[model samples]
Target: MSEKIYVPISPPTLLESDPRANLSDVERALYEEVLKHFSDSEYQIPGIEEKGRLTEAEKFWLSYECLLRYLRAVKWKSAAAAITRLESTLKWRREYGIEDIVSASHVEPEAVTGKQVLFGYDTRGRPALYLFPSRQNTDEPTRQIQMTVWMLERTIDLMGPGIETLALLINYGDKAGNPSLGVARTVLNILQDHYPERLGAALILNVPFLLNAFYKLINPFIDPVSREKMKFNPEPVKDGLFTGDMLMSEWWGGDQNFEYIHEKYWPALVGSCEARRASWLEKWRALGGKVGLKEWEYKDIDTPQVVDTKAADAKAVVDSEKISDVLTTESRVPTLAAA
Candidate 1:
């Protein structure tokens, strides 16, 4: 049986040049403007900047790419809004101990249930993250959330240049341990708000009848853009969007005999993470020193609206049956089955 390996590949040449080249004229201009704004010392996130852990070179690389990601997330419309969001994320990272997460060497034992794993890349070269909810071993909501975030961060770091997005394959094979609506909502909020434009596609596989009903109840809250990107059990391998040879035999109709072995996979992932970190540090040391955001600036923006859980639950109950019908109808959409 052939096995797939995950490692960081070289970034695209375009990124090596001016990262702005990847954007449109309008977007490029906005990216540059935002970059300049963040370069200023006055614009620093209070406690984060004060730490002074990041070297000058690291700051430059971070400011350049980070600002671009923020702009891309908001579609480059509002500079003030993007800045506000970026600053908020920096603050959140500080509170969340994201730095420690990246540096950690071992996978959380509870998180390694042979359920969620990073597979090969998609046709677009975006990494594919597979999740088997039925294999979930723990009901601790916080740990689940943490594992989700950890996987997301690792996937993001593994991204190659020109491939900022990712593909998610959620296998609801029995639908026995599906996360609750509240958990789903929290994950959605994190992705929509913090990781903008990061999801290229979400392919839900082996969805049971009951799970389809749940999808229906929760579908309304999902943004239209996100809804458009979602596919319910697509045949990418058959359609040639993905090569069957590259997929594990357990899923996607491939022939390769692949099974999740936690003991083996976890150590490989740790090594990959360490190597990637070293590569990033080397690159930062070489180029990070020359770049710096001299002065900082600040802007005022309103906080995002909070979700009403009570109203959401009531609505879900009211629309449960209706959602089944909606899913049945939507299943006929040609693109949904086409990868």
Candidate 2:
């Protein structure tokens, strides 16, 4: 089987104080207070000189759900803290020129050996991202990090309405050493700081002593709250996020026999992603083509208005050796639907 249907996503993790989530009066109040902070035009950061406002484009990318993520990350208090982090991310996005990496040639070389692969989905239909340190094909830290961002952005773009996270699988196969503490810390910082509350889980496999020690050194850089989501040397099936068939086979572990051939996998992966972005952009433009639009709206997926604070709700293996199918059916709109 090339693909299997999965359950809708559960209420994404850690949504404590959002009306759109568990719809308690307390949650409604908290949601409003956070909104109030950004809803005002005169909002100001205590220590910053720039306006504490997100540009329309930035707001579009941040989405209402994303703001709630930062709020939940801070335990539903400290609107100031959440906004501060949001502002920092906006600044970083500008300085980083992240959009350029979408089609960047510099990052292409790193992915040539299929070091990073985005394929399939977990039990709740969260996109699965696989990393193989053993497949390391590059030595440049900067471009390596850019490739990480590219992969992440693609993952997010592939998320369905009820899904907001990714199932991260890191398989450090034989003799594939660990990243420098500096590189690891920088990547962790990006995930924790800019991409708050977005990791559904991190399943690490084949951890060597060196990699284990490397984790110890980077512990401080990881947020304690998010740290709990990391599972070391986990049984993917028993851990409950993935089924064997859905998991990548071979060095990664699972039922399917799959191998990554860069040429075929790359184009299929990029084509699928571009198709998704095209669909999203079309819907986004229909909805005023501006920011402040609810993600669930342009996302054009069913979601609850008021909730019980509960839950919610990919494929392609081209051949035996390629990924003809990358984005799962849920992630990509059919041409007719997109139109």
Winner by TM-score: 2
Task: Give per-residue CA lDDT, model 2, range 1-339, as digits (tens).
Answer: 445322111112211123445546665566666667665666643444565455555656766687777777777666677777777787777667776534546578888887888766665656788898988877889888989998898788767665677889888876787888788888988988888878987888888888888888888888886688888887776555565656666655665555666655665566656676677777877887654456666666433222222332132121212212233334442321222
Query: How far does residue 151 in candidate 2 sit from its true spot (Å)?
Result: 0.8
Alpha carbon deviation, residue 250, candidate 1 (Å): 1.1
After superposition on all CA atoms, what RMSD does each candidate show versus the true structure?
A: 14.1, 6.8
lDDT tens per residue, model 1, 43-117: 556567466344342364354556776776677777777878876776766666566652334337555676788
Q: Rate the local accuracy (lDDT) of all candidates.
A: 0.58, 0.65
Ten contiguous residues minimizing lDDT sum, candidate 2: 7-16
**Per-model tally of clashing residue pairs:** 13, 10
Q: Could you estimate the TM-score for every candidate?
A: 0.74, 0.77
TM accuracy, model 1? 0.74
